[model samples]
Target: MRDRHLYLLLLPGLLLILLFRYAPMYGIVIAFQEYNIFKGIMGSEWVGFAQFARLFRSPDFYEIMRNTVLISLYKLAASFSLPIILSLLLNELKHLVFKRVTQSVIYLPHFVSWVIFSGILISFLNPIDGLFNAILANFGSTPIDFLGSSAYFRSILVISDIYKEVGWGTIIYLAAIAGVNADLYEAARIDGANKGRQMWHVTLPAIRPVIIILVILSLANILEAGFQQVFLLYSPLVYDVGDIIDTYVYRVGIQEANYSYATAAGLFKSVVAMTLIITVNKLVKMSGQDGLW
Candidate 1:
C-alpha cells in the first residue's frame, strides 16, 4: 500500500512526459513522408531520404550549419566556465547580506522573457541616441551599427546570452558546492592549505561529478543555439553570422511551408545530439567518472 501511494505520486509526471514529449515523437515520420494536412500521416506519400538529400544539396546548407556550430561552440567555450568560477567566488564570501543581494541582482535577468530582453538590447545598441553609441561618441568614435553588422552579430549574441543565463547557471554549481562535506574543508585547513589551494584540491574535486554530468548533458544540445533570442535579435542584414539551425528551420519549415525538408534537418540535429551525448557519456565512464547512464 505504501509503494502504491508512491507510484500514485509518480503518475502525473509520467503522464505529462508521455503526452507532451514522447507522443509528439510520432510526428517525426513526417520527415520521411510528403506530409499533407488533408492527406494526413497514413495517407502521405513515402519519400525515403529525398528531403535529406535536398537539404544537403541546398546552397545555404553549409552557411547555416557553420553559423549554428560557431555560435553554439563560442557560447559553450565562453560561458561554460563562468558559472563554476562565479559559484566558487560567491562561496567564499563571508558577508551574508552582500552575497544574497549580489546573487539576486545577477539572477534577475534570467526570468525576463527573451522578447523583452532582445528589445532592451536593441535599444541599447542602436546607432543613434543609444547608450553604447552615446558612450562611444564621448571617446571621439563614430557610431557603429552593432545589430546590422554581420561582424558584430555573433559577438553580441554570445555576450547577451551570457549576461542573461550566467547567474542562473551558477545556482546549480552553488548547490553542488553547498553539498560538499564540511569535514573536507577542515582537513584542508589543518593541512595548511590556503583558500585557493583548498578550493582547488577539495571543493573542485567534490563538485567534479556534478560538473561532468552537466557538461555531458550540455553536449547533447551542442547544436541548439537559442531560437527565441536569435529570431528576435537577428535580421536579414546579419543572417550570414547570426542564423542558426532552429531559426533556419523556423524560416524554412514554418514560414516557407517546406515541412518535410525542415523535419529532415531537425531529425538530423536530434540524431547528432543523441550521438554526442552517448559518446561523451562513454568517454566519461572510461575516465572513471559518473555518467548519465
Candidate 2:
C-alpha cells in the first residue's frame, strides 16, 4: 500500500494503451471480413484469407514491394550512418557556442512538418523558374523535373530525408557519447592516442550497444518507406520508382474504398515488421550484444 501513489501515476498511461491501442485492435477482425462501413463488423461477410490472396495475386504487389525495400535500404544506409558521423563531429567540437549553433541549425528542419517541407521542396525542384532551374540556366544547362522523373525521385527522397533527420537522429548517439567514461579518454591520451584514434577506439566502442539497438530498430521498420514524403512529392511519372506499401494501401483503401483489403495489407506489414525485429534481436544476441527482449 506504500507504493500505491506510484502505481496511480502509471494508471493514465496504462489506460491509454488499453483504450486506444488494445481496444481498437478488436477491429482487426475486419481484415478477415468483407468490411462495410454501412453493414459494420458483425454484419460484414467473413472472407477468411480471400483479401490476402487477392493482395498476393495483384500485379502491383511485387513492384510496390521492390520500391518499398529499395527506398528503405537507401534510407537505412544514408540516414542511419550520417547521424553517427554528425554526432561524432559535434562531440569533437571544442567551441561550445559554435557547436550549439550548428546543432540548432542542422536539427531545425526536423521541427517542420513534412507537409510544409514538401511545399518548400516542390518550389525548389519545380524545373521551370525554380531555384535549381534558375541556377542551371546561368550555367547554360537544361532544366530538370526532379520530382517528376523516376531517375531522380529516389535520390531526392534519400537526400531530403538526410537533410531533415540526420541531425535530429544524432541526438541519441550524442547522449550515449556524453555518457562515455572520461577516464577512457584520459587513458587514450596517456597512451599518446590522437583525436581520431581516440574517437574510433574509445568513444565508438563505448556506444556500440546503443548503435546496435538502433540498428535493430531500424531494420524492423525496413518496410516503411516514408508515405507522407513520397505522397507529397511523387506523381504518376515517378510512381514506378516511388510507390511504397503505405501509399499503395492509401490508394487501394481510402481512394478505392477497399477496407478489408487495406486492413489485410496493413496487418501483413505489421507481421513482417514484427518478424524483422525478432530476427534482428536474435542475431544481435548471438553477436553478443543485448537484445530488446
Candidate 3:
C-alpha cells in the first residue's frame, strides 16, 4: 500500500508521455510511405525510401546539410564555453547583492519569446539609423546589414544564441559550484593559494562531473540549432550560412507541403543525433566516467 502512492504520482507523467511523445512516433512511418492525409496511414502506399531518394537528389541537400552541421557545431562550441565562463566569472564576485542583480538581468532575456527577440534584433542591427550601425558610423565605417548578409548571419546567430542561453546555462553550473566544499577553499587559502589558484584547483575539480554530464547531454542535441532564431533571422540572401536542418525541414515540409520529404529529413537528423549520443556515451564510459544509461 505504501508503493501505491508512488505509482499514483507517476501515473499522470507516464500517461502524458504515452499521449504526447510515444503517440507521435507513429507519424515517423510517413517517411517510408507516400504519405497522404486524406488516404491516412493504413491507406498510404509504401514508397520504400522514395522520399529519401528524392531528398538526396535535391540540389539544396548538400548545401543545407553542410550549413546545418557547421552552424550547429559553432553554436555548440560557443554555448558550451559561454555558460562555464559566466559561472566562473560570477563565482568570483564577492558582492552577493550585485551578483544576484547581475544574474537576474542576464537571465531575463531567456524568458523573452524568440519572435519578440528577433524583432528587437532586427531593429538594433538595421543598416540605416540603427543603434549598432550608428555606433559604427562614429568610426567612419559603412553600415553592415547584419541580418541579411550571408557573411555575418551565422556569427550573429551564434552570438545571439549564446547571449540568450548563457545566463540560463550558468544556473546549472552555479548550482554545482554552490555544492563545492568551502573547507577545500579554506584549506587552499591556508596553503597560500590565491583566489584564482583556489578556483582552478578546487572549485573546477569539484564541478567537473556536472560539466561532463552536461557536455554529454549537449552532444545528443548537436542537430538542434535554434529553430526560432534561425527562422526569424534568416532571409533568402543569407540562406547559404543561416539555413539549418530544422528550418529547412519547416520550409520544405510545412511551407511547401512536401510531407514525406520533410519526414525523411527529420528522420535523418534524429538518427544522426541518436548515433552521436550513443557514440559519445561509449567514449565517456571508456574514459572511466558515467554517461547516459
lDDT of each: 0.93, 0.94, 0.89
Model 2 Cα displacement at 179 (Å)?
A: 0.6
- Per-prediction TM-score to the true structure, in the order listed: 0.98, 0.98, 0.96
User: Per model, how many backbone clashes are there?
Assistant: 0, 0, 0
Residue 85 lDDT (model 1): 91
Off by over 4 Å in 3: none
Give the backbone clash total of model 2.
0
Q: Which ten contiguous residues of candidate 3 have the minimum total lDDT?
A: 208-217
After aligning candidate 3 to the native by TM-score, how far in Å is the CA of 172 from where it should be? 0.4
Report the lDDT of model 1 for residue 164: 96
Instruction: Rank candidates, lDDT, best first.
Output: 2, 1, 3
CA error at residue 12 for candidate 3, angstroms: 1.6
C-alpha displacement of 186 in model 2, angstroms? Answer: 0.7
The weakest ten consecutive residues by lDDT in model 2 span: 78-87
Runs of candidate 1 exceeding 4 Å displacement: none
What lDDT tens digits, residue by residue, belong to model 1 across residues 1-293?
A: 86999999999999999999999899999999988878998999999999899889988889999999998888887667999999999999999999999999999999999999999999999999889999999999999999999889999999999999999999999999999999999999999999999999999999999999999888888999989999999999998898888998899887988888889999999999999999999999999998998
